[model samples]
Target: MVSYAAENQLVHLLYARGYAVMRAPRSGRVGLPTPDLVAIRGKKVLVIECKSRKTGFTVEREQLEQLKEWKRRTGGAAYIAWKRTRLGLFLKLADVIKNKGNVGKKFAEEYGIKIKNEE
Candidate 1:
């Protein structure tokens, strides 16, 4: 099994920001297309796929498609949270899918969304 430390960190962050979050159980093994985390705060919704790596990371096209479908169905925002170090980078799914799922370190650092409260 893969470590979910990155996802847990993200959950805590979202929780601190007042979002009610749920982590999909057995995410990749569930046989259904689902993101790693779903967070909702009032009218806003966020579906996130989390990844942790020492360098860059790649998301499969199928996974990207799944996220797109989820966004379409839920009318929520989709994101990819890539954790390369202690603090992670958050990239909009729309932007990442345009690159065909390759999130290089440079691109991540340049384009990743920076939350105001992130330490």
Candidate 2:
């Protein structure tokens, strides 16, 4: 799957969970740090980065740092989701991952909801 497809799936999941979501446009070529999906529930907001995984790959440190900066600046949650797994597994794992005191937890605490993985 492509990155956009993963992002769309994540947006759909967020919407299903009662969060308002928006997708970043693909037509722009500016040097802005556009998040894949932006979701909001109550006072919480999330900036998500979507990834397509095919095994033997994982989130990198630089990307994690970038997400952390985004979360800090926006006071929203930041997450990365792999789009190669079952939706149920994704959400279930998301619950656990989001609870960890890291980027996910920071975002969740700010937004009052969990930041789930897309896959």
Taking all chains together, the TM-score of candidate 2 against the true structure is 0.61
Tens digits of per-residue lDDT, candidate 1, 2-106, equal 248777878888999899999985735658888889999998999988887877778899989999999999999999988776657789998898888998977
Among all candidates shown, the one with the greatest lDDT: 1
lDDT of 2 by residue, 1-119 (tens): 34666667677878988899988664662766666667899999887766565442344555556667777788886666545444311222244244442333334234333345543
lDDT of 2: 0.57
> All candidates: CA RMSD in angstroms?
2.1, 7.4
Q: Which ten residues in a row have the lowest lDDT in candidate 1?
A: 110-119
Q: Which residue pairs overlap in candidate 1's backbone?
A: none
The 10-residue segment of model 2 with minimum total lDDT is: 87-96
Error of 1 at 30 (Å): 3.7
Candidate 2 error regions (>4 Å): 25-29, 58-62, 87-119
Model 1, runs deviating above 4 Å = 27-29, 115-119
Clash counts for the predictions, in order: 0, 2
